[model samples]
Each structure stands twice: as structure tokens, then as C-alpha cells.
Target: MTVFIMVADVFTGAHVWQETAPRLAAAGSEVHAVQLTGVDAGRPATSASIDLETHIADVIAAIDTVDTASDREIVLVGHGYGIHPVLGAADRRPQRIARVVYLDCGMPQNGVPALATVPDQALRAQLAEWAQRGECEGELVPPARDEWQRWGSTAGISDAALDRLTALAAPQPLGTLLQPLRLTGSVVVVPTTGMLCTRNGVSIDLVQRLVDLGDPMLTALADSQVTFFELPTGHWPMLSCPAGLADALLRAAAGEGRSLRPVGAGVPPAHLRPFPLDVPELPRDRREHVDLYVPDAEGPRPAVVFVHGGPVPAGTRPTPRNWPTLVGYARLAAAEGMVGVTLDHRLHDIADYERAAVDVAAAVELARADPRVDADRVALWFFSGGGLLTADWLTKPPAWLRCLAASYPILAPLPGWGLTGSRFRPARAVAHAGALPVVLLRAGRETPEIAATVEAFVTTAKDCGAHLELVDVPNGHHGFETLDPPEEIRPALHHAMRSVVTHLTS
Candidate 1:
């Protein structure tokens, strides 16, 4: 016999699983939608003392209720804050949990609270500040129906379902989120399934990319027991498409979803690849975050400040400034009668682009302040994800800013990034880049997700009549600078360099 337990929190309950649970039962499984302590619908009075431990105990009790003699396969499906109790229960009863499902959630770490795992970074900081200030002591009231997207995407949810959600949603007990999660090492090896909500900013492909990055912490994601699935709907799949969510859940239980493997067969990691250029390495003025590659035959010369892409691992050694490709670009710029600048920005997570932008701005200021750099003539070159940083300079091109360039860039924010009202959207801001020479070195063979963003920005730039020069590397990949042969990409590299130099010098 197979037993499935459902868990969710904050303005929702087992009731949210109302539509999906029956479908699971019909498909030959016993389903239990475990209502947690303080927010249990059966109890009208919410005890302030009810915390995460209360709900964790509730799930364990639900698991224990299943007959032991029947020999059951227990699958715990956790959504949002519900994952806390599910994980807690799984930790205590690792032997009983057949599989664990992570449904549209920011993966919570052992020592962190649910609040720390929130997808919205700004909101997370705001909530933490509010809690520390003692503004929301007892519980956090549910967001209004329209504000639901602040927590997660609401793309596929219908009006009636949203109304129901608002009506049934309960105040999330603040204490439940305040306590740090404690876990035993036993739960680390549990078989896991991840159901990604593509509209919520994660997909199987994105997860695969992260796993491919070879981060030891994320390597388990590529384990054979861990599989993945993508739902086209938004965060609330149970409310949006119960039938589909039910079907996926059933498939997940059967291990019918996509399996991922780490990138180690033949292809070298993108960053570890050798720099494509054979330019003479120049001595760099290694300041803290910003590094300057001064030209040998230079007075005060034009500077091309290279901003490397990331939300790279914060602990990544030989930081961006020291990366061969970045160093190569700086040297190449220095060889072309210009100052080459590279900087380390804090883009260690998807939510950190804002802070990263600040770092970029400060780095640029630092570069311009140098006596070796001609502050009146400067170009900004961005790579990969750092391409989004072009928005600010494009929107309000300074007199000293000669040109802005991006190679294989993500100009707009992905949907799931939840970067609403953000200024880092070059696709939209390019319209304001009047007379600002914008050079884009696009990779023809870029990843589909990133390619789509590039295409959007290109279309917008053309329509808005922005001064744009597009150079296409038809056979190049995302990090083609190192991935492709030196001979193939060298011309394109030199062409882009000359273009930026012309904008700076001409």
C-alpha cells in the first residue's frame, strides 16, 4: 500500500489539496492532507504557543496512524512553509519516508528558518526587519488576493480559486518561522522528487544547469534517487490545475519524472576552460574588488570595465577578477591602447543582482578615479547574467559613458526571479538609450532560456530605434570565449574590442 501525506502553510491548509487528493486516491493511494496545529481548520482558536514543533509532531502522528502491518510506502509532499514540518517529520522518521517531494519552494537548509528561505529577497529582508522591530509578533496576516504573487507566482490560478484561497488562508504563526530547523544527518540520504513550477521561476532545465555547475552542496541533486518534473502552471498547482498536479504527483511517486546527471563525462566546466585569446598577460593593479590592467604604452587611456556574470557561488575561489576569461578581456583591452578593468561583484544568488549592481557601480567609480584611466572615455562590457546590469547605464547614459556592450546576456529578469519593479531590465530600458552606442555580441547557440531574453531585447531595441550594433557568433555557445576554439572566436572578440575602442576614442 502507498500512503501520501500533503503539507502546506500560510493562508493555506490541507484544504488547498481538496481537488488533488481525490485524484491521487482514485489512482490507488491513501492520501492524508495533514492540517498543522495553530491554523488547523477544525480548531477555531489559534494558540499563540503553537509553533513548528507542534506541526512537525502532527505530521509524525499522521504517519504513525498508517497501519504498520500493511507495509506502506510513504511519500511526503510539501509546499511552501508546509515543507518545514514535512522535513522535520522526515528527519525523525527517515525509515518510514519512502520519498520526499519539494513543491515550488526555495530549498530550506537545516539551520535556517522558513522566512530565510523565502523566494523574494526584498520581501525576506523586509519581513525580517519587521519581525526584529516587533511589528508582527504573534502572526503574519495573509496577503490580499492580488498580493499573492509577492510570495509566489499566481499565473495559472483562476479568479474563483484565488477568492477561495483568500477566504481560507490563515495567519502564519510568526513563532513557527522564528525557530531554526533542527535535523539529524539520517534524513540527508532520503529519496527526493522536485516538482518545479516553471511560472514560479524554476524549471527542470534551470535545476539541471545548477547541478551541472558542480557545486558539492548541489551534487546530491544529481543523485539517481532524486528526480524532477516541471509544471507549466504557477506556484499554486493544486489550486490552478489539480488534475495535472495530481497526475504529476502520481508519476513522481512512480519515479517517472526526468533524471539529472552531473556534468563530468567529457565537456569541461565553462569557467575552468582556458581563455581563447593568446594576448600577452599584463600586470594588474589588484585593488580590493576592482582590478586594473594598465597598458604598457599608456598615458591616461580609455578604460573598458568588464563585468563578469554570476550569482556565482560566494565562496568561489580565484574570484571573477582572477578568472582567465575576465583577465584575458582586460589584457586584450590594454593591448588595444586602453585600460582593462575587472571587478568582483556580489551576485552570489539570483536575488542578489541588486547588490551586485551596486558593486558594479562602485567598481566603475573606482576605475574612473584611477589616474591611469581617462575618466572622460569609458566603456562597460558585461558577460552572461551580468548583462542585466546594462539597464542603468543604458537608461541614463552619462557623458563619459561611451558605449555599453553585452555578450550572450540575460537582459531581462526571468519570471520566477520575482524582480518586480526592478530597474535592471535592459530590454525595457534600451529604449531610453538614445545615441548611446550599444554593442551586443550574441551567441547563436545560447541556451534557450537565455536566448529568449536576448531575442526579446533585440526586438525591443530595434523597435525603439536604439543605436545598436549586433555581432552574431552563429556557432558559439554561452561561454564561447573559452568553450570554442581560439581561432574561431578571436575575430569576433577583436571586432567587439575595436568597436568599443572606437566609441571611446572616436
Candidate 2:
């Protein structure tokens, strides 16, 4: 196996990988360090015109130069700013890459530039100031060595190495930071691993916090088939904990600690049988497949269509074909003697709500048409962001839809993804709803914005004469059912699931 290590930059990469690459090579792996354009000591400084695409080209060229035959499996590793170019290169040459590793750096999402993806708002402001100053002088922004020292790890590196690193540092191209990443969502096919540095006390919990806060980069990473490994070191793990980082990367490449069974495995005994519902119209790459969990009984059974949340921003790909929470609900539906149908719908930006709605409708039609499902007694289960797409169906629900179950749904347009004159407003939809029952599951510790949306939906639905039942989980958060809440909250979780099952069964 071959490991292509993309150094964070001319200086940091030189210092960080000095110890790490040799360790990987000693383990019988070939190592190649990527050198970006205009990053060497003798090379001329890059201009504002030198951008992310240029660095991406450099990475691809390096890969080509090192792997002439392209027969060996290549592991793509990136650190700091290097992650951006490496991601771009992976997008370009996904077939050649086996695994992608992110080392103590934020992941990048399509359409988000390196500068915009910086997690620290204060740092973003400082960089903006630097860019402004550079613009005034008609020169590219110079590298901030002091800022790098403040943020980077100096723990394991000797004093001599630190001095050498400082001396070798070169000014980074401002355009690379300013340029937004472009991806076709295909890069997600390559498995990704995160080597997180915990010296700053950053843990998987912190990553989850970022996901909860809707950090686009973290959210995208979480949605992918990514595993995290914690290293008790500083931000530059390659320099601070090279040996440990090397071991973690090797383990990740070998798929250690991952489930041996295929994805969407571990369905409980309750789900009598599970099978995929094939839709020929959708391309295989789109992953628009559904799984049907039918009860053991022979005759037609009452059914509930489970729709997962996340109209995940456009250009982002969801890794797992089926979410475990939704699958659990499917099993619960089966346990309650009803057929459970979990479908994958197209997740698009708010602007493409209509297209996604069509996917939902297609899923419903498929469920109703199945001989195993009782067409006249079907129900719809909407979770999280998928709740927003239920407006039309809720407003003028069909005769066959018995009820609707919404858990921590986003009823209104989320902050940044709002659309003008859109018909996908839950508050307005409930005003025109038919005589159908709706069960609303509210999480107590949900973010304020989501809480407000739930509250408004409940209030407006009641005022509009919509029949609604509220199930309160006092100790739960937004993803309580899936988050593996404490034992105390288990009863509430079961109760909520039961409420939905009972409503659909009734």
C-alpha cells in the first residue's frame, strides 16, 4: 500500500511529517509528500491569482509522479490547509485513492471556501483584516508565523526543529484561502477518517456539538462514512504524536473497530424481513433506494412511511443508505404489527423542495402499491428537516394517509436556506389540513430555533382546528432517539415510539 501525505504547507508539512512518514515507510508502506506550487524556498512567491485549483493540480501531479503504474492502493492524508487541496485531488482521482485521513483539521464542503470554513470567527476576522491590508498594498497576504505558533502544536518538536520550521515557512497564497471548493459529491465514496488532537480537550463530543450547531464542514464529515480517532496531543499531531498518529492511520485504513457486517446491519428480531425497494428512475449513484420492513403475518398490514431528516445541503452526499434511528422505528412499527417502509428521498437545497417532494410522493406511492401494505391505512412519519417537506401533504392530505408523526421537525425555512413565496411552510400548511390526526414529538433540550419552530407549529395548528397530540420528552435533545440517551430517558423514547406506532396502527 502507498500513503500520499499532503503536508499542510511548505514549512509545516516539512516539520510535521519528518517523523511520521518514516514510521509509515518502516511499516512497509510507500510514502510520498506533496509539494504545492510556489511553496519551496527557491520558488518565487505566488500572487493573488494562485488559488486552490492550482494547489489541487500540484497534488495531482505529485500523485502522478510518485505512482507511475497507479496499481497500488493509495491512502490520502492531509493536514491543516493541505486538507483542502487533497480533498480536491481526491475528487479528481477518487478511483486511485483507498482512504482519506484528516489530521487535526476542519473538513471542507463543496461551495465553502477555505477562509469561510475556518471554525474560529475571531481568526476569520483577523484574516479578513490581513486581506484588506494586502489589497491596499496590491500584494498577497503574507503568512502569519506568530498566529501559526499560537494555534499549532509545539509539544513534541525539539527547539532546533521549531527554528527550522520557522525559517522554512513561506507566505501562503491568499487566493487559495478565498476560493470555494467545488465537488460533485462523488468524493464521499472514499472512506474518511479523522485523527483528532485532544490536547485542547477537543473530543468526539465537541465534534457532535459542532454538528448540532450546523457547522457545515463538521456536518458534512459526520454525514459521510467517517471514523474518528482521538490523539492526546496538540493540533499538529504528526509533529507532536507521530508514532501514535501513524498507528491510528494504519488501523483506520484496516477498518479496525468498524462493524464487520455491511452498513445498515443489526436489525432487531422485531423486523420480520427487510428488503430494498428499487426505483429504476433514480440513478444508483443517487442512492435513492428504500427498505421495506414487513411483519411476519401473511395478509396486508397497516404501514408507516419513515422519512429521515436532512434535506442535507445540495452537493453533499449522505454515506449511509439507511439511518439506524429510522430503521429502529421501522422495527418498532413491525413489532406493533404494522408494516414499516423506510425510503430514501432526494435531499436538495430549499430551492429544490418541489423535486424532493416528488421523491417523497414516489416513496408513498411505492409503499401503498406494495401487496404487503394496507394502502387505505398508511401513515407518514417525518423526522427533523424532512418535516419541512410535509407541508403540501399535511395541508391537503390524501384520503389514504391516516395520520402524520413528526419528531423534532423543522416546520419553517431554516435560517440560511429560506425561499420567498414557498408553499413549504408547516404553520400555513396546518391551517388548511384535513381531518387527519398528527402526533408531534418535542425534545426538551432542542436548540432554541428548532424549539421555536415546533412551538409555532403547535400553536398555529391548534388555532386552525387541526387535531394534534403532543408527546413531550422532557430530558431529550434534538436527536434523543438516536443519540442513545441515558436510561432515564429510555422510557420517554419508548413512549414516543409507541405513540407513533399506536397512531399508525389505529
Candidate 3:
């Protein structure tokens, strides 16, 4: 028999998993929803001074309850903020885990600090939203009922359930959100997968970003074993559409492909051959013609335009080392019959960052106009400098583009490590903002020095009113392009991407 361990997002107790566990159990899988340190499983409660180590210990203790059966393996699923604790538990007992899934969340890299890798524009608004609820010693309080609904999707849940969630949600442990996770061994070696629900009224854009980032994090492996699937539901699939969500869990537990659609629903968009698009020239006098990939057989499918780093020269097409995490996403989106566009934006030297931002914005407008693309569902995918550019574009973007999926984008103006002439400052970016759903990913292992910067951004964003998700991946790096990453990295990336994709597409 397969075992399922469920973890709740921050401020949400184990009851958040109440509506989800039985569905898995009915499908011949054993499910366990764990409550981290200082959180009560039944009633609403809050904690203070609780740190990552405390949460890690709680997860470890929960996992120990599972009986050791030589025949089958345990599948641990960490949702939202719980990813940090779940990963720490796996690190302590990697051998016991059959596979790990970060339901809409990803693990952090070593040496990187906090969830700072995500852009500031999106994060700032979210921080401000949380702060309005009232601050308890620096950390923002959880949202009220209407506030949660505004930022999150509450589809299938009853009115009473929604009220309970709002009433019970409390301020999360400030230290835990700021803590960077550390991975001990090769966690990816265990079969890992990411499941994203891409229905309306969710956080699909953020999920896709994590899915694409999975490529580089999982490149050490020869063949792509990591599974990435999209569900047409909201972020809280368990609460929104429990039956469809349970089906996905069963498939992953069985190591089966998740391409099949919801219960009786038709299959996802038919697979199409990877048709290459003619390179498009940049408007104005720029000398660059970006390499473009747009699907051939289609009437408006979900479309995404990628923006790579370096303004003078656009970042290269995702290679296994640099962008292996994106392969499954591009393939899956293509399979879903969506128009996928990858472009080279001018690098730092070729054009000013602002100019590059305009270039990306133009690409969004172009994608929105394409017949094979869904102008209403267009998304922007960016990383590092690309992230910086995307945020800049979002600040004053054209009216057409709908959502953004920016991965580890640079928002501040301070110089990054070893990279002179580049500036990133967290405090200055969120000075003005609006409602934007953003999923932020950061590695604790690679960029520890920037942890403070990320925290500042997250706190500020919470202070603002925006939808936010902050994930900490252990053994991760600045770009997550390291060779032979501890196996968990890519799976976590897939998890995060799946979450963003759900929000954007749904």
C-alpha cells in the first residue's frame, strides 16, 4: 500500500487537509495530514518564536509514525509553506520516502537565503495585504474571510468552511518564513513529480515558473523522469475539486502518467509536433531577431512568452544545464496544444534594462494578438534579469496581457554576488504596486547573504495587498543550474511551476 503524508500551508492547520485525506484513503492509499510545531490540528491556533528547526523536528516526528513496510514506499506531499518542513523531514530520512511531491511548492537550494529569488513587484503587494490584518511582532496576520477569497480561490468549499478558514487562520511564525532550508542527500533520486491545477481563479502563472525551473535542477539525470501534470482547477484543489485532485494523487502514487483529464472530462489538448516559428525581429533599430516557437495546429491555446536574462544578449534557449526545468513545461504546454514562444531579449550591454522590458512587453502584445494564442490567458515567464524586466513591464504593461510568471527575477538595484555593474535593491522596488498573484521561490543553500533582502521584500509584499506564495528550496542555487543537484531540486521546481500555472490558466 502507498502512504500519503499531507502538509498544510502557513497559518492553516492540519484541518486544511481534512477535506483531502479521505479521498486518497478511499483510493487505496493511506493519507496522513501533519500539523507542524505549535499549530493545533483541530482548532485554530498560532505560535511565536517557532523556527525552521522546530518545524523540521515536527515533520520528522510525524514521519516516524509510519510503520516500516519493506514492500511499499511512502509518498509525502507538502503544500505551500509546508514544503520547507517536509523537505527537512526527507533529508533526515531520505530512505523512507518513496517519492516526494511539493503540491504547488518547491524545495530550496543550499546557501541561498529565504524566498527572495521571486520578484519584488508581486511580493510587495502580498506583504502589504498581510500587514493590514495587523502585525504581531513583525509578521503579518493571516487574511480575513473576504481577504482570503480575494487573494485565493474558494470554489467548492461551503460558506461555513470558508468562514472557518478565515476565522482560524493566524499569523505564521515569522522566523519560519525567513528560514532557509538545507538538504543533506540526493532527495531527487526518489521519484519526484509536480502537479499544477491550471483552472481559472488560481495561481497558474507561479506554478508554470517552477515547472520550467525544474529543467536545470534535474539536469544531472540522463532521462527526464520527473512528472509534470496540469489540472484545470484552482490552487486549493483539495478544497475546490477534491475528486479530481484525489485522482492526481493516485496516479502519482502509482507512478503513472497524469495526462488524463478530470474524471470523465475529455483528454487535454492533443499533442502537436514541436513546430519552430520563424525568428522575429525586434521593433525599432535593434539588431536582434529572437528565436521563436509557436504551435502550428491551434485556435487560441494558452500562450506563454519567455524572457531570458542579460540585456545586451538574450539568454540562450534552455540547455539541460541551465534550463532543464523548462523542458517538461514546454512539452506539456505544447501537448496541451498551447502556443509556446521563447525569445531572446537584448542583454545588459545591448540595451538598457528598461528598453529590454519594453521589448518583452511588445512580445506579450504580439502573443496576445496571435490567432493560435489565447489573448485572455497570455503569461510572461522570466528568470533573474528576465524577472527584473518582466516586473518592469508589469509596472506599466499594455492592456492586453493577463498574468505573469517571473522566476527568481532581480527586483532590487544592488549588485548580486560576484556580478558587478548589476544593481538590486529590495526596498525601492515595491514603492508602488497593485493586485498581482505571485509565487516566489528562493534557495537557502546558494545565496544566504541575500536572505535578508528576500525577507524584506516578502515582509513588504505582505504589507501590501497581493496574492503571494513564498517557497524555500534546499540545496538550490542562484539560478538552480548546478550539476548533480541533490535530486529534490527539480521536483520542487516542477511543484512551484505547477502552482503558478494553475493560478494563471485557471
Query: Top lDDT: which candidate number?
Result: 1
Q: How far off is residue 98 in model 3, in Å?
A: 0.4
Cα lDDT tens digits, model 3, 65-143, are 8887556578888776677787778878888988777675534676432333222224433544443443313454676
What CA RMSD would candidate 2 show?
Answer: 12.9
Ranking by TM-score: 1, 3, 2
lDDT of 1 by residue, 1-506 (tens): 67999998566877999999999999899999997776867644455566677778889999999887787799999998888889999999998888999998767788777778766667677777765775544777888888887778787899999999999889877767766678877787789999988777677766765665667777778888989998987889999999999999888888788988666857665676778887786898987789999987748999999999977877666677888889999999988989999999999887888899899999999999999889999999999889888998989999999999888898888655657778889889999999999999999888655787888998989999999999888899878887787787888988998999999999
Show model 3 residue runs off by greater than 4 Å.
Answer: 41-48, 69-72, 117-138, 149-158, 200-215, 218-224, 258-315, 318-506
Every candidate's lDDT? 0.84, 0.67, 0.56
* Window of ten residues with lowest summed lDDT in model 1: 42-51
In angstroms, give how far residue 297 of model 2 lies from its true place: 56
Clashing pairs in 1: 11-169, 11-170, 201-416, 311-347
lDDT, model 1, position 500: 95
Query: TM-score, each model?
Result: 0.86, 0.48, 0.51
Between prediction 1 and prediction 3, which has the larger TM-score? 1
Steric collisions counted per model: 4, 0, 87
The number of residue pairs in model 3 that clash at the backbone is 87
